[model samples]
Target: MSTINCFFNTYQRRLEDLEKKLNRDQLLVADELTSAERELAMEMVHMGLLENIAQRVFVTKQFPINDFLLRQLVLGQGVYTGNTALYLWHLSDAFPYTIQLAVRMGYQVPKQRYLEWTENVQFKQVRQPRLEEDVKKIDVAKTTRKILVYSPERVLVELIKSTETDKELLKAGIQRYLRSPQRNLNQLLMVSKRLKAEKKVQFIMETLL
Candidate 1:
């Protein structure tokens, strides 16, 4: 091969190796890269081998850009709740238009200094003293990253408390949860009792199941 062809081949190999190293969950943050690796990453971005999702965030072409991944990228400190959590647990067929996140009452959302794209993310403050009551970490599908989210039982209770939620969607979510093989009726009741929604939850269950 000519010297130019040889150089191109070698460069291509290096990029491939770098891609492999950065493909963990198919997501990369600029801060995680060393100076030299940052240069290579930018080159990969230029070549369309990777995409710059935010200021310092890069994702491979295969990255699943869903609510879960977006939550991890932007609101790293909150748990998915409400409709977003319902969708994640497969209790609802409708995908949430905006990502719903729950954070501690006093928590401040991190400022996205480098986010180049706009995401419609809604953050709700969990005013309950025990904010982590039903929170759990779950693996994002097709990625190694585990995201914090409210358990299905907790989500059901939340739906009961929310006055603004769509009635049809709420009914659908409850029905789906009741029919799911993974449904834990005991857990659902426990969460509802703790949240002081036991009566409402029981009524919904009696009406539906």
Candidate 2:
């Protein structure tokens, strides 16, 4: 084989090996790559073999760029809440036009970084005491990653407390939860008590269930 042809074959083999490694995990963390691997990863990014979704985060091109991946990008920054959380719980069929995230008060959101993926992101800052209440890690379908989101009970309480949420969406979410097999009235009431929204929650529960 010619020298140039031999070099090209070796490069293609290296790229294929790297692609297999990234595909197995679905996500590639830049920090985990060695100097040589990092260089190849960047080349892959340029060739459309991978995508640099966030700082130090790259995903294989085969991965879907849906809400799940978007949530993964902001994993440590905040937990998914509001309409977005409702969708995650399968309580609503309508995907939120705006991705709503709840962060602790005074937390600096890297808005520009998130906007690079999608323009419909809203950050809700909550008090320190309430920020982490009832948060849970739920698995994303067809991927190895899990995303942080408010539990169904907590999401219900938030819907009751937030004046910004539409009444129709709130009603729909409540009705869906009431009908779902996973519904837990006890846990719902417990969370309502902690959030000091028991009266409103009870009124809705009484009217619906």
Candidate 3:
């Protein structure tokens, strides 16, 4: 017996219940459904274009998407990068770090973006994600999420500012980010202008350079 078997196997089903009611009382389902029956049901749903509306795909994890679908998803969502990511962290003091726009790439993400997020998010397109990726399709919470761009260094800087605000924390952050591969010296300098981090920035730039 399979999940979709009951749908095709039984005959005494209320049309309204079958169509509108999705609860257990929806129909007199069969004991089980065969793989063929399951596939057949999927095809019917797919052909009728009822998958999105009727069959909900609760994705919070990564999945595959061809290039065409990728473009369609990205363009449709109006996803952008830079300030979006920092916004997610709730820290926007620094100049934004633009890397990539938010879109689908059939990317495999470890975690999806959070729903009801404070700001729109963008991600960096890289090779390995966490390490860096051009596309991030994560299942954030209960929804399937995606981040097409990212800036590791900047993200690190913001995270460091959250819990540990001690001078030592900032100092350590400065030292660590000084030579970080993704560390944007230019952005850091720009942020230093408003934050009055000239001395700190200069010192780090000098050391890293």
Candidate 4:
């Protein structure tokens, strides 16, 4: 078969596998699979078709994927690193407990917005971030430096507004974030000044003991 034919076959297998796993009542990836299963699975990943797709599959799976790999998987990857694992390990946060994935800008939001990119998903509904939204970008250093996604000032301001109207729910979410293993307070404060809610921040600051 041609390389193009192999590529099509790869996606055909992937879609089938993904759908099968999603339909399962209780999934246990390691129960029925071993290292051999992973290699075969990787071979069918359309490796030559799209460079990113193969890399994403390998990095996301860590080991080989079988009939059990769920729709949402990834933590040991280089970009996300160990922060997520640390938080989960310590039960420090509620996020990443569920499916959590960030989409690259100028990309369309997917049907499975909380998981992987399925289609045209540019912005996340939960975040609703924008280039024109006066967001402060920060350079997060890792193996090499790269800009990480954030809305800094706007997101906090939005949360504060939500707190006034729905204090119970808003507080719960922010508190949950705070309880997480990794949170940048300095980033939060910097964002605070850029917000239009100076009075709101001041009120909270004054009330804090």
Instruction: Give the candidate number with the greatest lDDT.
Output: 2
- Taking all chains together, each candidate's TM-score versus the true structure is 0.77, 0.80, 0.27, 0.36
Q: Which stretches of candidate 1 lie over 4 Å from their true place?
A: 1-18, 34-36, 109-119, 127-129
For model 3, the superposed segments whose C-alpha errors exceed 4 Å read 1-57, 60-164, 194-196, 203-209
What ordering of candidates by lDDT runs from best to worst?
2, 1, 4, 3
State the displacement of the C-alpha of residue 122, model 3, in Å, after optimal TM-score superposition.
20
lDDT of 2 by residue, 1-209 (tens): 99999999988887787777766767676666777778888877899978876656778777776665555454456788999999989888888888888878987766666665435668889997788778888876666667888999999898998898888888999999999997999999999999899999999899987
- For model 3, how does the per-residue alpha-carbon lDDT over 45-146 read when each residue is reduced to its tens digit? 557522321122211113232222232242333233334444332334344433234434454332333221212334433333223332233223322334
- Put down candidate 4 lDDT per residue, 1-209, tens digits, no spaces: 99999988886776677435424412223323445544544553446321123223332223233211223222111111122222322323443333223433444443443344333222333334433344222332211122233343344455575443345544444555555554455555656766566677556645541
The lDDT of each candidate is 0.78, 0.80, 0.38, 0.39
Ranking by TM-score: 2, 1, 4, 3
By TM-score, who's the top model here?
2
Model 1 pairs whose backbones collide? 55-114
Q: Which ten residues in a row have the lowest lDDT in candidate 1?
A: 110-119
What does candidate 1's lDDT look like per residue over 1-209, in tens digits?
89999988877876776767666568776777677667888887899988876655778888767656554665446788999898888888888888788787987655565232225767688776667788887787766677788999998898898898888999999888878897999999999998899999999999998
Q: lDDT, candidate 4, residue 164?
A: 35
Segments of candidate 2 deviating more than 4 angstroms: 1-21, 31-37, 74-76
Query: In model 3, how large is the Cα lDDT of residue 81?
Result: 38
